[model samples]
Target: MKDLNKQFSLILLYALLFQGLYAVEIEFNADKTLLDSKKEILELEGNVSLKYQALIFEADKIFFDKKNDMFSGNELKFSSLDNFFYGAANIVEFSKTKLTLKEVEFSTCPCEEKIWWIESDEVSFNNEEKIVSSINSKIVVQGNTLAYLRKANFPISSERKSGILLPEIAINERSGLDIKVPVYINLRENLDLTIEPRIMTQRGYGLTNELRYLGKNHNGFFNSSFLQDDKESFQVLETDNLRWSFNFLHQQRLNKSTFFETNTSSTSDPFYLTDLGGFMSGLSRTLYLPQQASLSYFKKDFSMRLDLNSFKLTNPLAVNQFQRLPGLKLNYFFNKNNFKLVLNSDIAYFNKGGSFRNNEKESLSRVLFNPKASYLYNQKNYFLESSISLLYQFKNHQGNKNTELSPLFELNNSLKFFKLSKTTKIILEPYINVAFSDQKKIINKLKIDSGLRFNPFKHKQQFGSLFLSNQKDIMIGTKLTHTDKANNHFKFEIAKLSTLGQKILFIEEKRIDLPEPFSLKLKYKTNNGIIFKSHLSLDSKNNFNLTSNSISLNFNKYKILIGHYFARNIEIYNLNNNSLEQKKINSFEFSASVHLAKNWSGGFKFINDLEQKKNVNSVLSIDYENKGMVVGLAYMKSLELDWVSILENDTFKDYHKDRFRLFFELKGLGSIGKPKESYLKRRNL
Candidate 1:
C-alpha cells in the first residue's frame, strides 16, 4: 500500500509540473496524494502547500484539475510572497485571472496580531484589475464588529478609485452640529472631482465642489461652495438668504522660459468668511480677498512680467484699497568683470471702486523708469560697492499730470575677520551704507505705493532707501554681526535719514509727520534654540517712538514664544475731521506648545490688546495620538471688531465669539472630525 501511494504521488507531481509548463510555474508539497490520469485530476490530503508566481496557498486538503486549469481547496489559507495581503477561507477556487473565496476573512494587518480585519460571506480578487470585491462584509476591530456592508470594492494598487470618502462631523456654538460627506470621482488619470454636501443643525444646507486637473505643463483647481439659506445671517445684518464663495487657482508653463499663474477668491457677501470660515480666516487679519493674475518671461539677462491685481474688502465700512488693473514690469541686467548695469521699468493703471472721505472715485496711471550702474571690488577680508541710479516717474490722475526726476548715489563697504580652530571658529563682520538722493517736492503728489518705511534698518540695500518714500533723503546705516561655531549669532544695526529738500511726507494721499529718523535693530540667537529680536525707532529725544520685540525658544519636545508691539503717539490725518489725530498702539502675544506625556500634547495661544485691556484672541488645545488613531480637542475665543454696536450711552461695544472643536482619525479608514491644527495653521500660528 505504501509503495502504491508513493507511486501515485510521483505521478501527480509529474502531472502538476507538466501543467505548470503551459500556465504559471507551480510548486506543491503534500503528505498524501491521488492522481487520476484519465480525468486529469490530482487530489492531496494532510498538510498541502502550493506556490505559483507571488501567490501561495495552504490547506489541509486540495484538488487540482489540469483540464480546467483551476485549483479547489477546503480550509484554505493564502498570501502573497511579500505578505502584502493574507486571508483564510472555508472554500476557495484559484485561477490565473481570478481568485474566489467563500466565508472569508482578510486584512492588511499582521497575521499574528490581527489588529483589524474584515469578514465576508464571499470575496473575489481580480489579478488583472488588481481589485478586491466582497459581499456581506463586516469590519472588525480589536475582535469587535465596527461596521457592516452589503457590498464593497477597493483597489489593491496605488491608483485612485471613485468612492465615498469618510464623513466629517463638527460641533460649534455658531453652527451647532455640522456634518459633511464627500464623494470623490476619478474621471480620468489627470482629472478628479470631489463633491461634499454639508448640513448644520442651526444653519442651512450647503454644498461644496472641487475640480482639479493636471496636464504636462499645467495644473489647477476650482473650489466653490453654496448655502441655500443661513439661519444666523441676520446676526451680521445680512439680508441675502443665499451665501456662496469661490476660489480658483491655476499655474501653467507656457514654454521653457515663460509661465502664467492666477489666484482669485470671491464671496457673495463680506461676512461670509466670518460666519462660515474660509481660507486664511484665523491666521491673518484678512481684510481683503485677492484676485490676481500674472504672466512672466525670463531669459539669461532680461525678464518681463504683466500682472492684473484687485482686492475685495471684507468689511464694507473700511476704506477702499487701490487696484492695479494692468501692470507691466521689465528688467535688463548686464554684468562684465566687476561692473554691472541694470534697468527696471514699470507701468500700471490704478483705480478705486469707491470714493475716499467725500471725494469722487479716483483713477490714475503711473510710469516709472530706474537705471543703475554699480562697481564691486571684493577681497578675502574686505568688500566695497559703489552705485549710481536715476529714478523718473510720470503720473496722470484725473487728467492732472505730474512728473519727477531724481538722482541717487550710494556707497557700501564691509570688512570681515575670522578665526579658525580645530573645535571652534569665530567670525565678525562690520558693514556700512551711505545713500544720497536729490530731494524733490513730493507735496500735493498722489501717493501710489510709496511711503515711509517704519523699519528702515531691516532694509540694508541702497535700492531700499531710494524706494522708501517719494521724497528724496540721505540715509546712513551701519551694522555689525558676529557668529561662532557654537551656533551663536548676534547682530546690531542702526540707520538715520535726513530729508534733503522736502518738509512733509505724504502717505496714501494724506499728509503725515515724519517718522522717527533714527532706527535701531537687534537680534541674537543662542545654541540652545533661543532667539531674541527687537526693532526700535527713536525720536530726537532718544526715546523709543516705535518698538517691536519678540523672544522664542524651541526644543524637540516643546516651544515657547512671546512678543510685544508699541507705537507711541502716531500722527495721521483724519479725513472725516480734516485734522491730524494722534493714536497709540500696545499689544502682546504669547504662544506655547508642549508634549504632556507619551502620545499626548497640549498647546496654548493668546493675543491681548494692552491698550484696551482686553483679550483679542485665545486658543487652547489638547491632543492624543496612538499607533493608528488620533484624537484632539480645542477651545477658542476671539473678539470681533466688525460686529460692534453703539450702546444707548453712545459707547461702542464689541462682540466675542467662543467655539470648541473635536478631531478624531482612524488610520487606514477615515476621520470623524475636523483637525484643530488645520484651523491654527490657516491663521499661520
Candidate 2:
C-alpha cells in the first residue's frame, strides 16, 4: 500500500512539470525539496539539478513555478556540450523554446583564470532560433576591460550575420595610435560587405570599404580606401592632402573550356606602397601596380589565351610600361609513334603612354608563327632527342614594317653511368646539347615574348641575354647524384656554353663584349636531417672573378645562409678609347634562424656592403607562442633608394630610420601590432 502511494506521487510530479505541451522527459533531483500542491510550486535547496533535453541546470537554491515552467534561483549554472553560462540571478525563465537568465557572468573558456569573459545584466537564449542576446555587456580580457556594448546579439550558427566585430588597435612609428572599427553587412547568402573606419593620431582618419560576392559561376571582391591626411603628416610628406587606393579581383567560368580572370590595383601617391603597404599586403615592395585581364580556353590538343595588361608606375625608378591592347596566343600539340609536333602563334599590339621619360610615345604590332617537330629515342642508360623549329615574325614599329624568319635545330644526348654497391649507389649523367639559330631581322627589336624554339635543351645561361642572339652553340653539362642506404642524397651539376662565333650582348641595340662564365650548383641532404646547398660562378677569362655565389645550411630547427654577387661594370665609348672599370662586388648577405627554447625562436639577417664597408640592412626578431597567445618583438634598419632622377638625374641611398615593433595576440581575438617580414620568414609562415 505504501509503494502504490509513492508511485502516485511521482505521477503527480510529472504532470505538474510540463505545461501546455506533451510531457517530454524531465529529471529532477534535490537534497531538500518542498511541494506546495495548492499553488503548483516546488522549492529546492542544497545542490539542485534539473535536466531537460541536452541542457542541464545546477544551482544551490532554486524555486520552480510548475504551472509556467519557470525557475528562479541564486548561484545558477547552465551548460551543454558547446555552451555554458554561470551567474547569480534572481530569475531564469525556461520553456520549450527559450531560456532566459538575468544578470549573468558568462565565459567560453574553461580554464581556472578565465583569460577572457563577458558580463551582462541580462542574457537570453532562444533555443528554437539558436541565438543569444545580451543587454549591457562588458568584455574583459585578463581582468582588463576591453569593450562595452549596450546590446549585442550573436547567432550560434556558423553563417555570418549582422553583428559587431571586435575592434582592432595597433601602434607603430609610421601610423601612431591606430584604431579601427568594422561593421559587417550580409546583403545576401552569397554576398557580404564590410565598412571599416580608422583613426590614426599621427596620420588622419580613413575609411575602407570591402565588397565580396560569390555565385555559382563567378566570384570577386573589391576594396577601396580613402584617407584624409593630417596636417602634420602632410607637412612631412610635402605632397598629397588626400590619399586613396583601390583593389579589384574576379574570376568567372563561362563553360567547361573557357574562363576569365581580372586583377586591378591602384593608389594615388607614389609613397603609398612604401608607407602603408605593410598593413595592406605581403607584396609591400611592389613598384608598379598592374591591371590585367585574361580569357583562356583549353581542350585536349589545343589551347588559347587573350590577355590585356596595363600598369601604373608608382615609383620614380620604374619605367613606362607597354599596354597590350589585346594579346592573343594559340598553341596546338600532336604526338604519334615517337614523333611530337607543336604549332604556336602569337599576335599582339603594344601601346605606350603616361608620363614617360623624354616625352616619347611609340606603338608596335607584331605577329609570330612557330612550328616545331621532335623525335625521341629512349633506352635504359642513354636517351637521344632531336628537334627542329621554324619561326616567322612580322613587326610594324611606328609604321616601319619588317619581317624576320629564323630556323633552329637542336640535338641532345643524355648518357648515365652508374656504380652500385651493397650500401651506396652513384650515378653520373653527362648531357650534350648542340643547336643553331639564324635569327636575322627581328633581333634588334624589343619584343613581347620570346617565341617558341628548339626544345629538349633549354638550360639557363649564367649571363643571360636581354635580346635573343643568333648563334651556333654547344653546351656540355654533367650531373652526379649519390644516394646511400640510409636514404641520404647528394647532387652536383656543372655546365658551360661554347659559341661558334663571337657572342654579342645588346643593351637596346648597343653591342657589348661577353666573356664566358662557368656555373656550378650542388645540394646535399644527410640522413640525420642536415641540408646543404650552394651555387657558384666564375669568369675565368676575366681574372677568375667570382661572378655569383650562394650557400645555405640547415640542421634541425636552425638555418644559415650566405650570398654574394659581383658586377663587372664594363665601359663603352662612342668610337673612342676602351677603358677598364673597376670590378665592384655587391653586398654580402648573412641570415640565420635558431630555436632558442621550447617555445621561443629568434632570427637575424644582415647585409654588409663590400664597397662602403658598412651594414646595409639588418634585422633581428624574437617570438614566443604559447597557450593561445603569441608575442613578438622585432627591430629593423635598412637602406632604401630614393630616386630624384625625374627632376635631377641622380639617385641617393638613405637608411631608413630605425624602428621596432611589439606584437601581442590572443587566439580568436585581435592582435596589437604588425609582425614584420623577418618574423614571418623565420617561421616560414
Candidate 3:
C-alpha cells in the first residue's frame, strides 16, 4: 500500500511538472534550496521555515515534492490555528490538510514551557475534518505523567466531541476514599451524555448517568445514580443494601400558549441523601421525597395548571399525611380602569390507606375558590387601595363533607416624603393596613397542601413596617430610608398589629392576644463592604419584653451574626402555678470569616445551645488558592442535641470521629475533600 501511494504521488508529480503553480504560494528563507526538474522534487536545508495556506512549518531540513504539494521534514515544529506539534519526523500531504508526526509532543498550551502536554508515539490530524487523533498517548502536567491512553480523539475546532473529562477524588466519613471517572459523549448535534463510575472504598461502587436532549419543541435532562453497598453497616435503618436516586427535569412547549414540565426527585430511601457524600445529596436531607409533574397553559392574563404529585415517606406513621394524587388550578386576573379583578380556583383529591391516623383508610377531596376585587387611587407621593375578597371551601374526608364561606375586606394606604440634597436623599414613608372578615370563628385545624395545618389568617410584613393579614386584622407602620451618592443606604421601620376580637396563632401551636407589640428593624449598607442589620420582635403584654431578635454585622472581610428566639416555657410555672415562665430559646449561632492575604483565608462557624452549655455544630477551615492550585484544611464536629433527649432530661451524644480533611485541587482538574463547603454555602453560613 505504501509503494502504491508513492507511485501514485510520483505519477501526479510528473503529470503536474509541466503545469505552472496558480493559487499556491510559499514564502520562506533558508540557507540552501535544491530543485530537480526531472525528479519533480525540491529540498530546503538548514533552518528551513515555510508557510503555505494555513500551515506553518519549521524544520532542520525539508524535502518537498513541489508538483504534488507534499512535504516531509526532520526535527520539525508544525503549527496551525488550532494545533501545535513537534517531532523528529513529520509529514504534511494533500495541501497541508493531513498531517502525521512520529514520537510527537503536543499541547493546547501555547506557552513556552507547555505546563501541561501530551506525548504520543504517533499523532495525526485532518484540518478539513477538524479532528486530532493520537495512539499510545500519555498526559503530563509539569513534567509529571498523570494518565495514559491507548487512543484518543479531540476536536480541533469549537465543536462538541467525545472525550474523557477530569476525574474527581474525595475523602469523607461516609465514603472514606472515593473517586469518579467521567466520560462525555456527544451523541448528536443536540444530544449529549455523561457517564460516571464512582468507586468508594468504605462502601461499594456507584454509577451516575446524565443524559441531555434538545429538540424543536422539547428540551430537558435526566440524571440518576445507583449504588450497591456491600458493607450493609446500616441494617438497623431497615433499608435495602442498595441505594439510588433519580432527578428529571423536562420542559416542552406544546404550542405558543401551552407548556408541559416535570421536575421530580426520588430516592430509594429517605436516609439515602444523608448517607451520600455530595453537596446536592447532603442538602436534600428531607423526610419525604417529592415528585411532581404539571402541564400548564397561558393566554394573556389567564393561566391554568394540571399537576400530579406524590411522596415517599420515610416513616410508616407519616401515612397520616396526604399526597396530591392530582390537582387542577386556575387563575385569571385583568385590570379594568383603576379596578383589578382576580379569580383563583383549585380542586384536589388525596388518598391514603393501610393503618393511617386511626388504623383505617383515610381520603380527602377539596375544592376552593377565591375571587377578589381591588380599587386603587394612585399619586406621586401617596397611594390608597381597597380590596374585597370572597372565599368558599368545600371538603369531603372520611365520609364527612363540609362547606364554608368567608368574606373579607381590606384597606391600605401609603404616603412618602422625600428630601433631596446634592449627594444624599432621605425618604420617610408611613403605611396603614386594616382588614376584617365576616366569620364567627376560625378553623384552627385547616390542613392544606402537604398536610401542613395553617391558621385562617396569614401574616406578612411589607416595607419592614406594614403588616398585612389575610384574616380579620388591623396594622399601622412607617419606614425611613436614606441614600447617598457613595452608594450607601440605611432603612428603619416599625410596625404594630392587632387581631379582630380573636387570638392570632403561631406555627408552634401557641395563641397570642390581640394587639401585638411593635416590630422594629434596621438595615445599613456602605460602599466599603460594611453592612449592619437587626430585627426585634417585642412582647407588649410582658412589659414590652424582647420576644425575638437577630443582629448581623459585616465590615470588610470580617462578619459576625447572632440570633435569639423567645418562647414561654410551660414546664416552669410561678408560685401561683398559673403563670408561665418567659424564656429565651436556648440557642445561639456565631460565624466569622476573614481574608488573611490575597490567597489565604480562614473562617469558623459554631452553633451552641445556651441551656445545655455546649456546641451543637462547629466548623473551622483555612484555605489557600492561586491560579494553579487550591489547598485547604477543615475540621468539623457536631453533637446530636436531640429534642427528645432534652425533653427526657437525658444527655445527647457527642463525638467527632473522622471529621477532619485535608483537601487539594489542581486548577481545571478536580478536588479531593469532603465537598461540604458547597453544602455550607447553600445553607448561607
TM-scores for every predicted model: 0.81, 0.79, 0.77
Candidate 2 lDDT over 142-176, as tens digits, reads 78887897998865444577655655665557777
lDDT of 2: 0.68
Q: Mind sharing the TM-score for model 3?
A: 0.77
lDDT of 3: 0.65
Each prediction's total of clashing residue pairs, residues at least 3 apart in sequence or on different chains, is 2, 0, 0
Q: Which ten residues in a row have the lowest lDDT in candidate 2?
A: 642-651
Tens-digit lDDT string for candidate 1 (111-186): 3666677899989888766667999999887688989989988654446777888787766677777788889899
Candidate 1 displacement at residue 228 in angstroms = 1.5
Error of 2 at 472 (Å): 2.6
Q: Rank the candidates by lDDT, best first.
A: 1, 2, 3
Task: Give model 1's TM-score versus the native structure.
Answer: 0.81
Off by over 4 Å in 3: 1-98, 109-114, 126-131, 135-137, 145-159, 277-283, 314-317, 353-360, 442-444, 451-470, 505-517, 540-615, 618-680, 683-685
lDDT tens digits, residue span 1-685, model 3: 0111111223343346546554345566566666677666767777777765455678878887766666777667766645433323466555435666566776654355455667888777776666678899997877899789899876655567777776666556766777877888999999999898889888888888889999999999888888887656665764578777877889999999999998776777655654563332322444455567889999889999999876555333444456677899999998988999999998998765211133445678988898999999989999999999877888888778877777778899999999999999999999999887664433233344653321211223321001113366678999999999998999999998776565443322334343466688888888876666666656556444334345566676666566554333322323223343553345666766767899887777676787779887777888886655567887777664323223222222222333665676654334555433541332210
Clash-forming residue pairs, model 2 = none
Alpha-carbon lDDT, every model: 0.71, 0.68, 0.65
